[model samples]
Every structure is written in structure tokens, then in C-alpha cells.
Target chain A: MNYNWNWGILFEEPYFDWLVSGVEWTLFVSAVAWIIAFSLGSIVGVARTVDSVPIRAVATAYVELFRNIPLIVQMFLWFYVVPEMVPDDWGRWMKRDMPFPEATSAIFCLGTYTASRVAEQVRAGIESIPVGQRAAGLAMGLTTVQVYRYLLVPVGYRIIVPPLTSEFLTIFKNSSLALTIGVAELLYQARQIENYTFQGFEAFTSVTLIYLVLTMIVVALMVSVEEKTKIPGYGIQKDK
Target chain B: MIMLGDFDFGVIVTALPYLWDGMQLSLLLTGLAAVGSIFLGTLLALMRLSSIRLFQWIGAIWVNFFRSLPLLLVIFWFYFLVPLIVQGQVDAFESALIGFVLFEAAYFCEIMRSGIQSISRGQAWSGYALGLKYSQTMRYVVLPQAFRNMLPILLTQTIILFQDTSLVFVVGLADFMTSAVTVAQRDSRLVELYVFAALVYFVMCYFASLSVKILQKKMHK
Candidate 1:
């Protein structure tokens, strides 16, 4: 019990700024990456359900490749190997002129990695929809594209709101892997604070609490969305 | 030709012994964490399902707190904080193992909870009709079925555990990723070393997941 508790150092200048910017970067990386994950995941997921062999094969390959590797390794590859693989000009730009290279690469790595997981959810959501609905739409003279667009996609997305919420939270947590590539996110800032003040306990505790708060907010928002969009007697909603 | 020029298979050949040593440590951590988490997680899941209010609250909080935070943060907490609490030195390997087991238990707890709940109520009622106590009924009747149902999902989670074992590098543990980084830095062949490591991971996880899929299909049939 020789340690002196100095929780006050957190409020000091530069330290506070580190935490603020850390939160900003963490949120920025997660939010932008979420957009990529959802969009790409939806496309790949829908493709997986399609009849075309090539499209399905490519989508499955993307999921297998990205989902199998660890996020940190992928981030490192993006940070290091990808630059060398590209043309000399683009490589130089990535290393030099590209802003927030670590963040950008982290976003890509996290996005695509989580996209595989999200794609699984999206595919499951779409598959869960009754086949009769798709058949009904098609039987009414709607094109396959229009049938999916107007009938299936909207309902499938609504049905998946709960799993999507968990996925959203997972992406936020996974964003912490960005620290390996030096993304200066919340976890990185916590490490910096610990290094500077030797207050590892306080720094990590606060950051963990901040993350808990972020996830709680997300859960609450998604809960409200789920309630509003719920179709009667369809999806799993436990009645109290 | 340019791709072939950048890669030095000789470097990987030379680094094989070191990488093998690291892979052993990674596998050891995964096995240890997997067993420890499942045991602890099953307990938490049972507690969450218990009729007692206090037990349920404690289990709920533990699962929620761990589930909310990142694994890296938990690893850091153990690496820095455990030594202080124990009044002795805790090495990186032990700290990382403890962190993974505890953090992963939260996930395992949720999975086990769902698995337990998936069992039909009639199964438990039948045990009661046989004059079995609550604990005995759970042990003999309900748990075996739940465990069977959860086996593939548990194995899938272990595949994920194998991928996450790489995170030990953050605590300076000489796991597989750390070994790769060491070889890459020593020989200035970062690209080749990383690509090789990524391939190893991808192959292992991909095959394991494929087996999980097969098992899932077999079980359904």
C-alpha cells in the first residue's frame, strides 16, 4: 500500500486534452469505420445470398480472408505491407501526405474485419425473412432488384437492429486495436497518461468507464429504435 | 518477380525455431484461457439464472463490466495493477493469461446463458419428477444437453481465442506475433515476416471455423 492516489493529475492541462482528443479519435475511427462496415457488409452479405456464383464466391472469400486474421496483424499489414505493395507515388502519399495514416488504416482494417462479422448478421437477417414475402413480391411482377429493394431490405434491416447494436458496440471495442498502429485513440491516451504520471490504475479506470458510458448510450438508443421499428409477432422481443 | 525479390524464405527458415517457441506459448495461453473461462463462465451463467437476487446481481455486474471494456485495457490493468496488489512481480505471460481468462469469461457467460436457456423446461421438470434436487437436476440432466448444444459455438469462440492470442504482444509477451515482429525487425524484412504470420493465422482459424460449420450442420441433421 505504498502508492499515493493522485486522481488530480487527470484534470491538469495537456493531460485532459490528451483524453479529449483520445475520445474524439476513438469515436471518429469507430463511427467512420462503422459506416464502411455496414455499407460493405450489407453489399457483401446481400451478394452472399444472391444466385450469381462469382459474386457469392468473392464475398465469401473477402469474409474468410479478413475474418480469419487477427485485427492487429491486419492493421500492421495495412500500415506496413500495403504501402510497399502499392505504386511508389501512392506509397509515398500514404506515408507522408495522407492525414492520420494510422487512423485511416485502422479504419480500413477494423471496418473490413468487422464487415465479415456484420455480413454474417446481415445475411442471417435477410435469410430469416419468410421466403413467401420475396416470392410474393416477385410474383407481383416486381424485378428481383426491386423486390429486394422495396420489400426485403427494409424489413431485414429492421429485424437485425438488435444484433446490429451489439455489432456497433463491438466495433467500438475493436477500435482499441488501432492503438497497436499508433492511432492515438482512448486506449493510447490512457497508456500515455500512465507513462507520464505512473497512474495506470486511474487512467485505465476512467477510460474503461468512458467506454462503458459510450456503449450504454448506444444500447439505449438502439433499444428505442428497436421498439419503434418492431413488427408485431415477428422478431424476438421478450415481453415483460 | 519483384514480389519474389522482396521475400526472403531463408529468413523465415532461420527464424523457425524462435517462431516455434512462440507458437507453443500462444497455444498454451489459448488452452489455459479457454478452460479457465469456460469453468468460470458456467458458474456466472448459473448464478445469473439463480433465483436469488443477490447472486444474480453480482453475476450481472461482473458480466456487464468485463463485456463493456476492451481486452487490451483489461490486459493493461492486470499487467500494471496485479503486481501492486500481490506485493510481488507478475510476469507478462501470467498477467496476460489471467486477463484473457477473466475478460473472455464474460463472453462465455453470455453464451452459456443462452445455451442453458435453450434447454426445454420439460427437461428440468422431468428431473424433478425423478426426485432430483435442483443442483442434481442441473448437473445430470440439463447441463449435459446444454454443453452438447454449445460445443460447436464454444469451439468457434476458441477459434476467436486463437486469433486474440496475438494481443499478448501489447503486454510484451513473446507470443507468435511478437516472435514475428522480432524476426521482421532483426532482418529488416517486415513485409515477408508479417505476411507469413498472417497466413499461418488465417490457415489455422479458417480450418477450425470450417470444422465448426461442419459440426453445426451435422448436429442439425
Candidate 2:
């Protein structure tokens, strides 16, 4: 109960700059990683629901492989092990020559790992549509790809808003794992601030607030997307 | 595109005993946290389902707040913040353990809530027709069925908890991940040791998840 409290330390010169940069890196990494997750997840998800047995198997294997392992472990693998497994020159490029090697690996790791979860959301969305919808689309002379583009994509994505909302926010939370590999993100900066100022409470409090605000922003964004993309008579959304 | 050199199986072989000890710590954390969260989580779930708006809001806030934060942040909070609040030093293991329980409780509460909701209203009504009170209906009819239906999901979450024990590495708990990193650094066998660690986790969790799937299939019938 006798610990010193200092909220002012956060606004000081170097620490302030550190925190600003930390937030930048966090937003940068998570936003770009989300782009990868959504794109790859949509493809893998559609592939799983396709008629090609081998494609389904590959997609299923990708999901299992990514989902079964811990993200921290996968981050380490991409950061350390996977780079070493490549050709020597490329390994050097990844480990030494690459720009922001740690952040780059972290983006790759978080992107692919969360892609598996997003794929599940996407898959659930697609599969939840009535079978008759797919049958009807095909019966109307639409090719499989055209069916997905017109009917499935339009309806399926809307149905998955609730689940995908969680998945979207999860990418932000999981970006904190970048600290393990020395990405100077929010959590890492919080630790650094604590180390410098001996104000662990103040440092972490700032981070906690930043993260809570970040979550709200993400939720609000998803809510808007949900409202905009909502299909009539789908999902749990109540209508007027 | 992988070169095949600079790996020493000897390093992993020699570190086996130490790694085993670390594995025990990881399992211990998962076990203790799983048991602790289940009780707290079930209580929270009941609170959410209860008629009192106050209880419902408290449950909602607890789950939403914890679920929004990173697990790493929770670990840091327990380690750094709790000690200052209590004015006493909390060991890394206990801090990590408490963090896991509280954080996982949020997830468990959600699962339990849905499990409770999944039951047909007719079942509770049937109990009412048989002259059961609300508490009696929940205890004797609804909860038991919910637990049975939720067994596979609970097991799957436990598997995830096992994988998540690795996050304690940041706080320097000597869990399996820390042990792997330590040996990988000390013996200079980064690729080999890390690959082995990931393989061990993969085998354990992959099989655990498969079994959960099988249980789901059996429960389906």
C-alpha cells in the first residue's frame, strides 16, 4: 500500500515518444495482419466447403495445423525456426537483412494463426445458409464460383458478423504477443516504461486504458460493418 | 528449402529431465486454472442467467472486460498490479496461475451460458409441471443436461489452456516454453529445440482436439 504513484511520468519526453511509437507499431501490425487474415481466411474457408475432396483436405489440414498449436509457439517458430529451415541466403535475409525482422515475422505469425479462426467463422457462415440456397443458385445456371460471388458471399459474410466481430478484435489482442520476439508494441513499451520509471502501475494502467479504447473502436467499426452488410432475415439481429 | 545442419539431438536428449520438470509445471498450471475457472465460471454463468439486473450486469462486465484484453496483459496485471495492491511480492507462478483462472473464466462463462440456453424451454417447463421449483428445476433437470452437452467443449477449452501455458514465458515462469528457450539458447540449438517443443505441443493438443471431436460425434448420437 506504500507504492509511489505517478501519472505524470507518462507524458514526459522520451517515455511519451516511446508510447506513441508503440501504439503506432501495434496498430500497424494488427491492421495489416487483419487484412491477411480476412483474405486468406475467406479463401481457405470457401475451399473447405468446396466439392474437391483434396482441396477440402488441404484446407482442413491448414486449419488443424494452425489452430492446434499455440500462437506464441508459432511466433517463435516463424521468428527463429522457420527462417532457419529455408535456404541459407533467404534465412539470412529473414533473420538479419529483412527490415524490422521481428515485426515482419510477428505479422506473418499472427496473420496465419488468426486466419484459422477466421476461416472457422467464415465456414460456419457459409454452412449455416440453407442448403436450398446453394442448390437454387446452381440451378439458376450460375457456376460454382459465380454462386459464391453472388449468393454465398453476399449472404454468408453477413451471417457471420457476430463471430467475425470477435475474431477481428482477437487479432488486436493477440498482437500483444509480438513482445515475445522484441516488437516494440504497446505491452512491450509498457514494460519498458516500467523499467525506466519504476512505476509499473502507472505504465500498465496507461496500456490497459489504451487497449480498452482500442477494443471499443474495433467493436464500433464491426457494428457499423454488420449493420451495413446485414441481410434480411439472417443471423440473430432483431429487425423492426 | 531447408538446409540440414547445426542441429544437435544431443542437446535435447541431455535436457530431457529439465524439460520434463518444466512440462510438469505447465500441466500443473493448466490443471489448477481449469478447476478454479470452472467453479467461478459456472457461478458467473448462473448470474448472467439470473433475473436480477445487477447480477446480470456484473457478469456481463466481468466477461466482456477480461475477454477484451490480451492474456499477456492479464498476466502482467496480476504480476505487476496485484502485488502493489496487496503491498506484497507475488511469485511468478501464483500470479500467472491467478491470471489464467480469471481470464479463462470469462471464456468458460460464455460456454456455460450458451450450454444452459441450448436446452429446450419445454424441459424446464416439464420440470415445472412436475411441481419443481425454479432452483429445483435448474439443479435437477437443466444443469445436469447442460453439463453433459458441454463436456466436449469444456475439454476442448482445457486443451487450449494447455497450449496457452506457454504465455507464462514472459513472466519467466519455468514452464515448458521457458525450458525450451533456455536450452535452445544455452546449447545453441535454436531450430532443433524449438521444433521439438512445438512438436510436443502439437502432438498433445492435436490429439486432444481430435478426441474432443470424437466425443462430439458420440454425443451427437
Candidate 3:
């Protein structure tokens, strides 16, 4: 049976609102999760490199545990299991009083999951720097914290712009998983549009275009950042 | 108080056969998809690196498009769209396998391209100096070394592909995740089953990653 494609149906009132809000929530979820990933990953990543053995081991274990588990399972555990695990009143509060609880849980899950990835990047970035710099900082009487804060972090972050850019794109794609937990993001909206209209192809096609556009924008932004912050010889070259 | 009686290992023991069946399907998909994508990805990498503009454009567009989109969306598209394209009823298993191979070919292509390009230009030039054709040089000289160099990364990606196999649950395939969910709901022990599933996933993935690490160290050594 041939299918009659009505691309215009996506632009209709209710469907259009679904798509728009889907985009908004997708962006909102990814952006907030990125902030969480960056901050938490930075701490954990720095801790991994610290002189303290116990701190480093704990950080490493955190990365391994989070990194190894699939994100969807993590989302389920966070969404369905965690609330039930908590105190009775808190669980009720989560179910009732929490605003956009699904979104909150998705953010938490995605952020922490991506944080494991980001932590690895951060650790690699710091390690990529010359050991002499750390020695130089110490020679100048800077404490370890001051050394990382003033010297290692700035250079390492810059050095890792390319990887971080890829990580950002990854988180955006991963945000799609939030749909499984009923966040009504782009994929979820597309599924809704499909269920409503039986126009699976069109719904998925439009949302795929939005994803492509989002990733392109991220690529462009990150490339420009890479260009501006690139050190003379440390930046990645295309054919080198 | 959460009672120990509520958490039943006996239920998990009963569900083990079905869950294991699902795990087999998941592993089968990952294995097939890995082989297919690696073969196709290698071809795409060669096309991208080819001198022909048309080949380069085709390779670039395919890679970029799939790379830009989420794997879930790709799975959805193939699940719904391929049957229409092929004018035949494609089973859920076939659709998921096709979607995975196609989508992952894009990523694997990029990885293989980088691996191939990482070989020094002089190596390719020496092939030319020996009067070997481009394809022969690639087949004989370049690809072997490139594959060896890229084995660790390729395995790491395969582990990721293994994790991603769980996404097949979206299409209603009885993969591990879906099977666990089914059993959990059927048995009314969501917590125990999910926890068990997560443990299974974590153990497998952690071991795979550890192997990749070991492989990387061996290669470096």
C-alpha cells in the first residue's frame, strides 16, 4: 500500500506546538545537563588527578560505575526506583510537588552519565599538558590547588575543546533517551505525532532535521572556539 | 520497612531463561551489526579518501547525515520506512539490525578514515613507487596496518554498540532490556529485576572496557 505523505500536517496547530515545545525542552534539558556535567565532571576529574589516593580511587570508581551502566537503565532507576527508595514523604513530594519531575530526573541522569565521559576528557586534557608546567608552578611556590586552578585548568580546558565539543554533541543526542521516561522531548513528540496521525515518516524526518541542525550549530560554534583558543602546535589538524 | 521477603531471588531464577534468551538476541545483533558496519565503514572511508569528487561527496553526505542524527531516530526511521522502501514486510529484528548497521557505519567510517589517514603519506607514496595501484596499495599495505592500529578503538566502539543494542527495546523487540521490563512488570518486582539487569549490563560493559584498556596497553607496548 502506498502511503500519502502530508508534510503540512506537522505545521498544523497542535502538532506544531508539540514540535516547538519539544525543541524547547530538548534544548533546555541538554543545556542544563551540560552545566551539571561540566561542573561535576570538573570536580571529579580534578580529583582523579589529585595527590590523595582515597580521593582519586573514589573518583575513579564513580567514573567506572556511571560509565559502564547504560543510560536508559540509569534513567529508569532514577525515575522509577529512586523515588521508591527514598523516604515515604519524600517519595510523595517527588511524585506530587516536584515541577516537571521527569525533566528533573532526566537532567540528573543525563548529566551524571555524561559527567563520567567528561571526567575522562578532563583527566586526559590535564595529563596532555607538559609535566614541566606543574613543576614550574610548584617551583614558584604555588599549592596544588592553585597550580590546577591558575595554570592547568585554563590550558587543559582549551586543549580539550575539540573533545568537549564532541561530548556536547553526544549529550544532545543522548537527550533523546529522556523521551523514554516521558519527558516529551523531540523523539517523544515525534512518537506522539506518529501515534496521532500515523505519519511516522514525516514526524521522524522533521525531528531528524532538527537534530541535524542542532548538531551543525554545535559543530560550528565549537570549531570557532577551537580556532580562537587553539595554541600554536597543540591543536588537532585535519590531515596531520 | 522494606522487607527482605519482598526481594525474591527465586523470581530472578525463574526469569533467567527468558532474560538469557533476550541477551542472546542482543549479542547476536551487536555481533552482526559490528561486522557489517566495519565492512561498510571501511568502504565508505576509502570512498571519502578517494580522488573522485562524486565518491567523496557520497561518502561525506552519508557519514555526516547519520552522524548528526541520533541512533534512536535512525532506528525509528528504518523500522517504519524500510518496509515501504523494500515493498516487503521486514521483521522487527531485521529492521533493528539494518538501522544499527547503517547508522553505525557512519561512525565506524569516521574512525576508519582517521585510522587510514594516520598512516604516513610516505607509506602510500612508496606503494606508488613500487607501481602498485591505489586499491592494491590500500588492500595490501594500508588496510592491514590501519586495522591493527585501530583494533582497540574499534573494540571500544563495539562495546558501545553492545550497550546501544538495548535501544532495540524501543521497537518492541524482546532484547535484554525489554525482556527484563516484561518480567519485572509480570512478576511485580520492578526493583529487583531492574537492579539485576543493570548489574548484568554494568558487569559486561566494564569487562569489555577493561579488555579495551588492556589491548591499548599491549598495542602501545
Candidate 4:
């Protein structure tokens, strides 16, 4: 413990900017990936529960493929392998296309991988709703899509809220894997700062604290939403 | 598609020695860390459930701090920081093992806590009525049941840990991923080498999951 500790580096202008930008990227990636995960997860989840056998098979395949693969591999594939698969012109286009293409690929990989797990949560939520609701909608001469749109989605979302929150937290953590692809996200920024200053403790401690803050904010938001949409006497009864 | 057909198997053949060497370190790290984490995690779980507020608070914070941070960060912190504090040269593999134990302990704490909590409150009370001290009750009555209930989930977490060992490569440990990357660098076949590494990971994880499923069935009966 005799090593000199530098606390002032955190408040220095350049390092502060790095930290701020890192937080922004982290939040940005999480928010975008969450939207993709929820939307795609709902679609795939509903598909799995559909009456059509073929559709269910396809949905199952999607879930099994993605869920079984590690998130790091998926990120590497998206960032490295899939891009190589593109036609030469298109590959070049993507390579030169944007400034933050690595970030975009990371978002795509993280979001899609998480969506598979979210799909299971969605399917479970929808299935938990009594079949009678769908039956009532059908008996009213509603189309299958209409039944889902009007009846299934609302109730299913409420039921899936807690698990979805967990998935969101996961996506936030998985975003750190983007560091492997050289994206200057929070973790990457921390590494950069560490290498530059050789102040490993300060840099990592700052990164850890940032992640804790972000996750806590996400938990708080999810709790508020859960409270707002809660159905009385349902899942996860509140402790007095 | 760049065909994998043109690849030379000699790379893998030559790489086997290195892979075997790395596997020893990987398995050793996993085994040691698994044992350490389980013991520490169980202690933390008991502390969290204890009647004393201080114990509960300390346990909660321990779990939160380690669980929320990325495993890589945890590993890097220990790998870099421990030497500074202890003023001794720690090797890469030992540092990685220490990191894995600390990081995995947090997760194991959460898993064991839930497992213990799943048991009805009456079970503990029944132990108390039988004239068991708190520690005796936990050891004789509570833990056996909780461990049984948690065996499957615990196995699943082990599978996760197995894959997580790959992250140790970041700290320059010559584990599976590092060995693969080393071969890839020498042969200039990064994609195929990484794919092979992925296959190795998949097989290990898949078997772990299968064994857990079988164990779950036997335990239920």
C-alpha cells in the first residue's frame, strides 16, 4: 500500500472528458440495445407461442442459437466475421461508412444476443396470461394479430417487466465487451486512461463506480415503472 | 466464404502441446477458485441471513460490489493492485485465480442466498425447537437441504465460470483462449483458430449443462 496514489487525475480536464464520454457511450449503447431487445424479443416470443408449428420451430431455433453462444463470440463475429462476409463493395462501404461503426456493431451484437434471453421471458409472460383472454378475444371475432395487439401485449409486458429489467442490466454489463473491439466505451476508456497514466487503481475504481451508478439508475427506473404498472395481488408481492 | 478446407491441421497438431500446458493452468485455476468461492460465498450467504445488522450489511455490500463490476475489471484490479499492496511478485496465473475467486464469490453468494431463502422459514424454526444451536441448525438442518435444492443452478454457474476462464487471457495467462490466439498469430489464421477455440468452449459448456440436467432428475427422485 506504499505506492503513491493519485486522486487528482480523476478531476483533470482530459480524464474528466474521457469519463463523461465513456458514461455517455455506455448509456447510449444500453438504451439502444434495450429497445432492440424488447421489440425483437416480443416478436420472437409471440412467434414461439403461435399456433403454427413452423413458426414456433423457427423461433425456437433463433433462441437456442443465440442463447447458447457466448456474448463475446457474438460480438467478435459481428465486429469481425460478419463484416468480412459482406460483398467487397459493401464491406468497404461499411468500413468507411461511419465514425463509430465499431460501436454500432457492438450494439447490434449485444442487443441481439440479449434478445434471445428476453424472448424466453416474453414467452413465459405471455403464456402466464390465462388462455381465456385470448379465447375471449377470438370469440369476439378479433383477428389473431388484433388479439395480440389488444390483449396479449399489454398484460404480457407487465408480467415480463421484472425479467426484462434484469435483461437490461445484462445488456449494460455486456456493453463492456465492446472494449475488445476497441470502442472507447466506459471500460475501454478506463483502460486507455490506465495505460496513459499507469494509475490502475484510480482508473479501475472510477470505472467500477461508474458502472455501479449506471446500474443503480437503471434499477431505480425499472422499479418506478414496475410500481406504476403493477397489478394488485399479482407477481412479486411487495414487502410491507 | 473463405473455406476452412485449405487450413492446415498441423497448426493444431503443433499447438496441442501449448494447449495442454495452458489447460493445466486453466483447470487448476478453475478448481481452486471454485472451491474457494463456494466456501466464501456460503459464509457470506449465512452472514446475509444472520440476525445481526452489521453482518447483513457487510454481506450485501460485498455481493453488490463484486457482482456489479465486470469480471475483467475484477481480474485486472487484483492482477495490478495486489502486487502494489503486498509488495511481492505474484505470477499471472495465481493473480488470475485470486481474481476469479473474488469475482465468482459474489455470484455464488447471490445464488446460495436465494437457495437458502427458498426453504420455508419453518424449517429453521423446527431445527430450533429440536434444541439445535443456530450454527448447528444451519449446518445440520438448513444447508443440506439448500445445497441439494441449489445443486443444478450451482452447476449451471460452474459452466458460466468455465467460459469465464477465457477472460483470464486478458491478463496474459496462457489459458485456452490465449493458447489459441498464440497459434493463430503464428499461423495467420485468426478466424479458424478463434472458431476452434469457440468449439472447445461450446463442448465444455454443453457437457456441463447436460450433467446438471441429469443431476437435477436424480435429485428430484
Q: lDDT by residue for model 3 over A9-52, one digit each (tens)? A: 99998999999999999999999999999999999988899889
Q: Which segments of candidate 4 are over 4 A away from where they belong?
A: A96-98, A236-240, B4-10
lDDT score, candidate 1, position B63: 94
Q: What tens-digit string does per-residue lDDT give for candidate 1 at B141-161?
A: 998999999999899989898
- Candidates 2 and 3 compared: the better one by TM-score is 3
Candidate 1 CAPRI grade = medium
Give DockQ per model, in order. 0.66, 0.62, 0.58, 0.43
Q: What share of the true interface contacts does candidate 2 keep?
A: 0.75
Worst window of 10 by summed lDDT in candidate 2 chain B: B1-10
The interface RMSD values of the models, given in order, are 2.4, 2.8, 2.2, 2.8
> What is candidate 2's lDDT per residue for A55-163, written digit by digit as tens?
9999999999998888898999999888778887898888778999999999999999989999988888898899999999999999999999998877888898878
Question: What is candidate 2's CAPRI-style docking category based on DockQ?
Answer: medium
User: B142 in model 2: Cα distance from truth in Å?
Assistant: 2.5
Pairs with backbone N, CA or C atoms under 3 Å apart (clashes), candidate 4: none
For candidate 1, lDDT tens digit of each residue in A1-240? 778798988899889999999999999999999999999999989998887999999999998999999988999999989988888888999999998898999999888888998998888888889999999998999998998899878988888888888889899999999999899999999999999999888888889889999989988898999899888767734311
TM-score quality measure for candidate 4:
0.91
Q: Write the per-residue lDDT of candidate 3 for residues B15-127, one digit (tens) a residue.
A: 99999999999999999999999999999999999999999999999998988888889888998888988889999999999899999999899889999988999999999
Is candidate 1 or 2 superior in DockQ?
1
How would you order the candidates by DockQ, starting with the best?
1, 2, 3, 4
DockQ versus reference, model 4 = 0.43
TM per prediction: 0.97, 0.95, 0.96, 0.91
- Find the candidate with the highest DockQ and give its number: 1
Considering only N, C-alpha and C atoms within 3 Å, which residue pairs clash in candidate 3? none
Candidate 2, pairs of clashing residues? none
